[model samples]
Target: MTDIDLNQILTFVKVVDSGSFTKAAEQLKQPKSRISRRLAALEKALGTQLIYRTTRQMQLTETGKDYYQRCAPLIQDLENANNAMTSHSVELSGVLRLTAPEDYAKMILAPLLEEFLKKHPKIKIELVLSGAYLDLVKESIDVAIRIGTLKDASMKSKRLSSISSIVVASPGFLEKNPAITKPEHLEQVPCLNFNVGQKNRWRLVKDKQDIRIKANGSVEANSPELLYHFALYGRGASLIPEFLCRDALQSGKLVHILKGWTSGAIPVHLLTPAQKDIPAKTKAFMEFASARL
Candidate 1:
């Protein structure tokens, strides 16, 4: 091909991602006819069909899939390079895509974003709230605020904060049961478990020694808030993040148990794919979350 058309390829990629000429045009802010013509020109240049068009939708052919996988990263890298050059500006611009857990997104991040948007009106952020671990490279996400520890060696991680899990129970429940003085005594109490692991097993440590105890409980939940509610109603003892239960503990709604022992410290991480030129938007948002959270 004569000086392979980069713009045409970008337009084609946008069309493929959007799955419609009109949608691509809206995203690219171009005319629909222009997008159609660009895709046609790209196909002619490659001398093979890239997309299989249908009345209702569009699908990528085998060659198109390969090309997309190759070009998407290149296009993103170029955009990142361009963004990096302007990253030091006082005013933030462009899109910032972030991913984090559901509770953090709701209880912590949503309020922060509300204040952030008020300060910087030019930036647009797309927040994906999920419980599963996400691949930043495959999804083209700018940053991820992860809760646990980081195991991936390919990414740059900054420890935002350390969260320690606190075991709590209602006054009435504790009144019925004896005070928890040792780790083994927990077996006698009704324990509310989160999504950490099996119902009966809890990993804890004391005096530089690790201990695993089999906990018994009637209430099991996937959410910390639900467990908090259950503990409030005298259902069972629950281990939850200190940030979530600090207020409740102060108000005497929940009583902290085993004050001398600790469950573990969960490191909150801010992860980003190793890129040469991180965008200003991403950097600004990362700094904001780091400063606030």
Candidate 2:
């Protein structure tokens, strides 16, 4: 029996996972020719054709499927062991991919990331900011910061903090429009609606009493940051995160309205994929963010 090359096996697994040699080569930081050569060498050593490749697509053979099913887990275990071993002896260094809401990333995470990077200079970060919940495995995201209820039970989550929502308007807008003395008064004024998850309605709570008001407005947007700006410009009253409006409220640029009523506290969570072993870099960021956020 010929002594098999572990590198060839690793290359084979990479090719299968990536679905093409070109992609696998790019990920491995090797030439396409080298990836092909490795796959050919691996097949020769095994005495079987593992992959059926063409111009458009690549498919695994019967033996290849069985081999991959067995090999993938073993490869993961080896990589995990290597990561675990190296993490203790050396500084954490790897590209950590993270995703979060755009506004939150800019206002909250930007500074924290700067600090995190300063602490771990060797680590590189790839941030994907979007309002949509991206699939972790498909997007290859290492960690995600999310606000509100988590629907996916498959992912592991760590509760960071609870963010309370504030209903606010600018001093100028309040002077020109109807004064909001209670929750019912909100309907009479122009409300800057944040159209995400929920309808054009604002939910307010005060001491066990829950009130739902149908919000009518001239401006509606999916971004809370935009709404915050609109509120500052005295466009309309906006229901936004308190953190986003705290400075404006203090400076008197924005006035907190319906003081006793709140939109309720939304839970913030750090999410990671469900796996046997979490990479040290991902774990480090999660812990770092958990304490600070």
Candidate 3:
């Protein structure tokens, strides 16, 4: 019956995403009343109810859910196209949300962000350092630096680095514990574990032969940084990425064991949403990280 406006659609999406008119208003930098009025206008213009209000929480009606499922992609596409087209001249501005494991964040990403921010002075960044696999679409992440094989088949990825796992232990631990002459010797000493495939297994490869060992340890955690610390403290030997332990291995904090064998090269990736054109901020960060990593 009437033409729907982009502002109304954006406002509705913001409200749904933020979970309340008050919160959405804060994100939009608009008054709560203005946000409510826009959402009300959208419903009136459509001639149907889109949401049910309970005075505390907002729930989308069936129509609203269906509408959001369709409109969100369209809205994202519009913004992405505009960003891609204008990015040539517009000095990248806006908050870039990123996620990565804590070890990478501390050892690699933090410094990169520092240099990137200096060059792109107008851009802001939000970094989430975690080992959890977060949904890019649901979490509104701009891009993520992830290790290992990419799981989300829909997301586009760029290879940032190829890192091989190195077996290591503290010098003190090696002195006190039995010498590791072969892969199976790892079972006798505690093995600080990293989460892989719901089990603790290190598959070492050398000269086309593979040795599989079920890692046993007192300290097992998802974070490579934590495991590195554990090894540094002589808690156990751990199979960690060479990139993560290279500095320590050289500085004598951690000793590399089984030097001839490796856990193979694992590809690190930069992931972005597959549905949209690469926005300037995300593209710039990815490029900066790719070259540096």
Candidate 4:
């Protein structure tokens, strides 16, 4: 109807999507009172109550539900049109918040971020590193680089690459231990376990044959970097991502075991929140990382 009405409808859509006025305000970068007033004004202008508010929860009324269903797609289409028009002309500038595993951030993302920042001097980055999966909306994360199978169907994902695991141990440990000639030999030796809720089972494939073994290990950790270090110090053999221990393998500090048998490959993905319009800086970083990593 009016320009102010259009703005209020956008706010209403955001509140519905976010499930609360407080969260919607945070996302829209506005005060909670302002968001409340806008919604109230919208109701007065339209002569219909859209939402039933409570201290603990919010629910859309019958009218609100129908209105929201109609408005959401129209709003999304408008945003897409706006982004398409301004994308090429606008120089991307903003804080792009990202999250990833601690070890991967240190080893892989550090250099890429540096390069990306150099290219776009106006953009700033905030990186959160953790072993556990963080909720993108809850944490306000713009992008995430994750390794393994994705469980959250709500988030959008782009597969970057598949990382292969290598079973490795130090030269000294191998000298003292029994020869690990076949996949079965792994069960006899002390193996470093990457604990991720599963049992200490290592699956290897060789020449169309699949073998699974329950690896016995004295040290078990959730972090791959720790496992790599333990293997380097001659503590035990470990299954780790090839990129993490590439330098050690090259320097002869760690030796690749079970040469013919291969550990399975884990899929790496670039994750983003399921939203209609992605921020330019976040999209730019995703593109940059997808090409390089």
Against the true structure, whose lDDT is highest? 2
Task: Give model 3 RMSD, 1 decimal.
Answer: 9.0
Model 4 score (lDDT): 0.89
**Which tens-of-lDDT digit does each residue in 197-275 have in candidate 4?**
5479988887789888899888999999999999998999888888899999999999998886667778999999998
Q: What TM-score does model 4 achieve against the real structure?
A: 0.73
Q: Per-residue CA lDDT of candidate 2, range 170-194, in tens?
A: 9999999987998899888899999
Model 1 agreement with the true structure over 175-211: per-residue lDDT tens digits: 9997888888988889988865546688787679788
lDDT of 1: 0.83
**After superposing candidate 3, which stretches have Cα over 4 Å from the reference?**
1-86
**In terms of TM-score, how similar is model 2 to the real structure?**
0.71
- Residue 54, model 1: lDDT of 78
Candidate structures ordered by lDDT, highest first: 2, 4, 3, 1
Point out the higher-scoring one by TM-score: 2 or 3: 2
Looking at candidate 3, the ten consecutive residues that score lowest on lDDT are: 79-88
Q: Candidate 4: which stretches are off by over 4 Å?
A: 1-85
7-102 per-residue lDDT for model 3 (tens digits): 899998888877889989998999999988888899999988889998778899999999888888887787776776777677888999999988
Once model 3 is optimally superposed onto the true structure by TM-score, how far is the C-alpha of residue 285 displaced, in angstroms?
A: 1.6
* Model 1: residues with Cα > 4 Å off, grouped in runs: 1-85, 88-90
> What TM-score goes with each of the models?
0.66, 0.71, 0.69, 0.73
